[model samples]
Target: MPLPKESHYTLADVLSWEEPDRVELIDGAPVMMAPPSRAHQEILTELTRQLANYLEGKQCRVYPAPFAVRLFERPGDRPEDVRTLVEPDISVVCDRDKLDEVGCKGAPDLIIEILSPSSLRHDRLTKYNLYQRAGVREYWIVDPSARSIQSFVLESGHYTAKDLGTPGDVLKVHVLDGCFIDLSKVFPEAGV
Candidate 1:
């Protein structure tokens, strides 16, 4: 079971935390993160590599996990009021202004979350609604155990499920034009 949230945390509090554990602030609460498995790391590495290669010389850039993202529900919310902070497995940002020395100030163009046993619910439900509410253009949920990738595109302030690909399929990123990832390489050793 997940640990009880420390509900008083904000982005500043999360940043000032002395504990070494990986964590994220969700709706003014602190949620501890589990260490990723080997398969999770491998998948993240490959996806980062592919995204970086595809975005070369482009205005947009991709960032791997441990990068902070502050999501606000309203446009003019103060820093203290902006509570949600996430470290997505992969994030692509096209708006250069959103990038700062600390982290991303707003939603990224694309956010990808790799599902682990510990994060399945939060990623699929909590973060799904959070990203959609914050106006994220695209979201990808990559399930290593299930060997599947699900893509969602934001339309009319809501997410529309666009593609669900298995190991043998290739998935195109709607946010990143002219870029597609081969699912075979995404889940190797699996006969799909």
Candidate 2:
């Protein structure tokens, strides 16, 4: 049965909200997001460009930040019942069913979060635990300041991570078989 428009919202209300400030909801609490820096946007651009290029004509698709992602959806759950809502720097979703007009219903196939000064702890700790608990297939924490990236793959209901410290390092996406991220191009400091 098709749900009535207002009765059920995957992210419709959140996306169409009048609030200009961006915030993420965790455990039903709103956490304000700081404005991103130019460096942050630049890194996001390179990463998004790489992912988008690889996903073209493929079943999977990529979405950049400002897209809503309601994680851990359960049967008969309303939008207000969802405990976590995040805006990852990049989201790659392979299952079309999880997607809706406003945002994604559950965990994306792969999630990438770029580090910012204000978001460091939130991304590394808070979101790390959330994504792991939600069974996110792959999670990446990109640290531009450190010129490193940590890739985590869900194995046996837990995340096992691999860190690529050098800017020239390349990481093959576990979920997307043929996809690889070349850090050299992702960071301007690479090959320095």
lDDT per residue for candidate 1 within 1-192, as digits (tens), equals 333455466766655556646778887777888899989998899888888999999999999998989866345655677678888999999999888776788899999999999999999999999999989999999999898999999999999999999887889999988999888788888443
| Residue 111 miss distance in model 2 (angstroms) | 0.6
Best by lDDT: 1
Residues 76-151, model 2: lDDT tens digits: 7776577678999899999998998758888899999999999999999999999989889999998978877889
Cα lDDT for residue 65, candidate 2: 93
**In terms of TM-score, how similar is model 2 to the real structure?**
0.88
Question: How high is the lDDT of residue 148 in model 2?
Answer: 79
lDDT of 2 at 73: 77
lDDT per model vs. reference: 0.87, 0.82
TM-score of each: 0.91, 0.88
lDDT for position 29 in model 1 = 76
